[model samples]
Target: MRTALLLAAFLCGPALADRQSFPPVDEADRDPSLVEFRETLLAKIAARDVDTIVALACPDIYLSHGGDGGPEELRANLVLDPQTLSEEYREDADAMREQYWTDLENTLSQPGYFDDEGEFWMPHQWQITLPASLDAHLAYFVTGQNVSLRQQPNRDAPLITRISHEVVILRDHQSSAEYQRVLLTDGTQGYMHSDFLWPMTGHRAAFVKSDAGGWQLCTFVSGD
Candidate 1:
């Protein structure tokens, strides 16, 4: 009876108003608690806290001196926790959805979306499908280049621009649509097309600059 009473008292104890939000410790500051850091990062992104992102991210986050296109472009790459998003963020998500749908509608309503290149296709803009399945989250790749990889869907154009954290592929005949996309870690997805992805049957995707650039051999579905 006494133990039960003491437990009840502990449960009913007064809440501490002075409880720290994030723990202030050496490890917390230096090592950065992953969960807490992720949460805080998402929260700041949701609120468009560009200053916080600039402070937290490495010096070469986007490689434009941390002040490239500012918060708007940064927010484009950010996905927030659905549970914690503010009403404004909810509205923003809705807007993004609306924009995507609008773009799709515009493309589909064209004179010949599937056949006519000049009618439906625009330079430097594309809507390639993501390679891997994603959850409720939506993602897209935008090129800073003018020309796409397709020379009528089966040839390589000139190297337009350098894509960071991305690999380029040369187009050739006998390429398959299934191998058109560049796979990503975390089972997410990336961009590539039959026009750009050089197919190698029974061989994993390899990065080679000039067919010889910064190359890294990857092992998918293999325990490394």
Candidate 2:
């Protein structure tokens, strides 16, 4: 008897599915290494912590994902020329199953690539160290949807900081509204929205820019 082999490929971008190969990043993805304490970053974004989110990303970070038409396609979905999504999309269990199966079928039908688990890299911690004079903390920014930044500690920049999802900075201080602020990375602080920011786990020291953009040590919020 001949048996058909089922090969699965995971696609990036917003296409949702259940057996769709790569599982969507859930609460687990935000733990320990990624960046902010999952909840606090959420609070910051709900609060609109603009300055905080931007401070956490690496400089030269550009967004990409599978399923996207391309980079520009994803950017069009994220970059807010006017507005952003207000609530998280909670897929109905049955609907998710249907989408998952459909995507899974499409993925399995394609020729599979050899993925060596050992060759794959999983980040234990994502960090962002601002220039000596910037006053702020670091975080993870998810590009595409809204700028979802998870605030955390420092890491080397000028490299692609792989995350489960693409993110951007939150520059506000309130704990409920997604604040607006400048993200200090890639040698410049770009403007980002507040909705997408989340807090990384554990507290780390940070700096704030003086009137002259000089770093002065600052205190981290309790959950920061």
User: Root-mean-square deviation of each candidate, in angstroms?
Assistant: 27.5, 23.1
Q: Looking at model 2, how many pairs of residues clash?
A: 59
**Please, what are the lDDT tens digits per residue for candidate 2 over residues 94-139?**
4543443333222222221111221111111223222233222434
lDDT of 1 at 120: 18
Among the numbered candidates, top lDDT falls to 2
Model 1 lDDT per residue over 1-224, tens place: 00010111111233311111111112222222332544464465456565665455432223122445333333343433334456767757756645533432332222211112211121111222222323202222222232243223323543323232222222222334532333222222233443323121111111111222221111111000
In model 2, where is the ten-residue run with the lowest total lDDT? 113-122
Each model's TM-score, in the order given?
A: 0.20, 0.22
Clashing pairs in 1: 208-213, 209-212, 209-213
Error of 2 at 80 (Å): 38
The TM-score of candidate 2 is 0.22
Instruction: At residue 181, give the lDDT of candidate 2.
Output: 43
